[model samples]
Target chain A: MEQNACCSRREHDLQRRVRAFAEERDWGQFHTPKNLAMALAGEVGELIAEFQWLTPEQSAEVMSDPEAGGRVRAEIGDVMIYLTRLADVLGIDLADAALSKLENSALRYPTDQVRGSAAKR
Target chain B: MEQNACCSRREHDLQRRVRAFAEERDWGQFHTPKNLAMALAGEVGELIAEFQWLTPEQSAEVMSDPEAGGRVRAEIGDVMIYLTRLADVLGIDLADAALSKLENSALRYPTDQVRGSAAKR
Candidate 1:
């Protein structure tokens, strides 16, 4: 794919690409929702590993290190790939799913109630 | 607040509650964007910690265990709380932010290109 082709792409598009990539290889059979969810969790675990035990400043440096940053980015991509695929498999429009959740959140966190709170009631 | 009052609320509402909880306690001063981001990362770290090295089956059990599940939920709540606050501080509508990202993804992941793929490029 052209670099520019992905430059303007959104999360769902990346997800689709990953899914298509898998499908082209006949990997869909392996992508059961449960498995996909596990894959996502694993990728997230990888992401966390990148920063494990790092001080805040070191964590910042990790993001700046080409190798570490690339690894982290790849892991993030992996998580998103599974997430989008799972959403697609479930017939969910990621955008709509996110928006609906946001709407519900708006009602729960009225400005007055959640302007700067950190504690859970 | 009444449990019933919170039962019907959304993610944004929960975020709002957390933010308000902090604000009411004069904690906004501590919620700089960087700090909030760090806090979010910390919460995510905690979430991941709950399942570190567990087998997939074990992870499922963790979620089913009331104690582990509660910790995970609390961590997730912490991440969301920081995320919503960051959105609020940045003047973003979480719903709109998520929707906008989704719209971008839809374009990128046309059905023809992304039916079941997993490879990048």
Candidate 2:
């Protein structure tokens, strides 16, 4: 499929590639929302594990170091893979969904109210 | 300051409010990368805790039930609040940053390769 002009080329491209892979192997059957969500969480956990116990400075460095960065990127890629898949499985346009969510969030958190306060709503 | 156009009105608006709140209390000095990062982690931990023991179905319900949903929203709000603040402090345009990241991801995950496959890179 050709990429959408308005959508982020990278994400849309990735989504398309991932979808084709699934189509070829007939893996959509295993991608139920629940399972996909679980997969997303698992990937997130792995991402977090990469930073566990690392100081803030150290964590920042991890992203700059080739080996550590590769791991981080790989884990992040996994999370996004599942996320994009979940979005695809549910028939959501990833870009549109994100844009809409941001729109809603703008209403929920007015800049004037949220600026620097760490106060939870 | 007025809100920026081409940005999420809600996020920019919230950021403005938060910034004003911070300015009012002179808290900018406290929002260093290290401290803010820690606060972010704490908020994330709270968000994760909300779903830790719940079954998938139960977790879904948690977001729909008024009480549970409210807590979930609060935690999410907390996370976003910190995230937005971090972006603000670092002079990032959150929407723009997201857009750029998505663009980069497209190159990394070509649609032909990624479709439907859950294979991790």
Candidate 3:
């Protein structure tokens, strides 16, 4: 499959914005891996909060409400932001890591063995 | 800032892997925006589970432990996987969306105003 040149460009683009955002405030000094990881968790919390009380079906439908959809998207964006920042601080290539994981998933849960079964194991 | 060619490549690479995997099981039909969004939320829930009981400081330190770190990494990967899948279904360009968001963030949270304060407000 051909790789999307644009995706790599975007990751690099997000990296710069993240780096510059931190640098402008001299916040680089605070972006320790531990701190960034915590931030990642926190942002994920906010993302989940948007669906805190919804039933499974409702959770699926959470976005049918414009206000809720907007919040979810913002939280999604926040998750992306912190994930990008964490990777930038750790020098991990998110795109590389993501691809590698998917490749591994392909291996771990072979189609013939895992198809029709949603369970991870 | 120069976009990283490699990052985009990885995203495309992941997309192919995702498409191939779903197609193998004929799961494409289930990839509705609502279902994908719900999956995204579920994955984020699992990610948060890794740090649920930890105090703020302990949450930051969660990854210092090898076992905990591995779990966190797995959950993080899961989150990324679902995110990529969701974006793919929605026809959203994660990289482009990410950049546009960062640009917006730069405007909303100006350095001088937000630097000293960690609050999102």
Best by lDDT: 3
Model 3 pairs in collision: A7-B8, A8-B7, A8-B8
lDDT of 3 at A38: 65
Model 1 lDDT per residue over A8-114, tens place: 23444455666665666566776654465556556556656765666655654554577865554454444445555655554444443434444555666666765
Winner of 2 and 3 under DockQ: 3
Candidate 3 per-residue lDDT, tens place, B58-111, comes to 755666788877666666677677777766664556666666667778888888
Which runs in model 2 stand beyond 4 Å of their true positions?
A1-121, B1-8
The alpha-carbon deviation from the true structure for residue B80 of candidate 2, after best TM-score superposition, in angstroms, is 0.8
Give the 10-residue window scoring lowest on summed lDDT in candidate 3 chain A.
Answer: A1-10
Q: TM-score for every candidate vs. truth?
A: 0.49, 0.54, 0.71
Q: Rank candidates, DockQ, best first.
A: 3, 2, 1
Native interface contact recovery, all models = 0.04, 0.05, 0.28
DockQ of each: 0.07, 0.11, 0.29
**lDDT (C-alpha, whole model) for all candidates:** 0.53, 0.59, 0.68
Q: Under CAPRI classification, how is model 3 graded?
A: acceptable
Q: Model 2 residue B17 lDDT?
A: 64
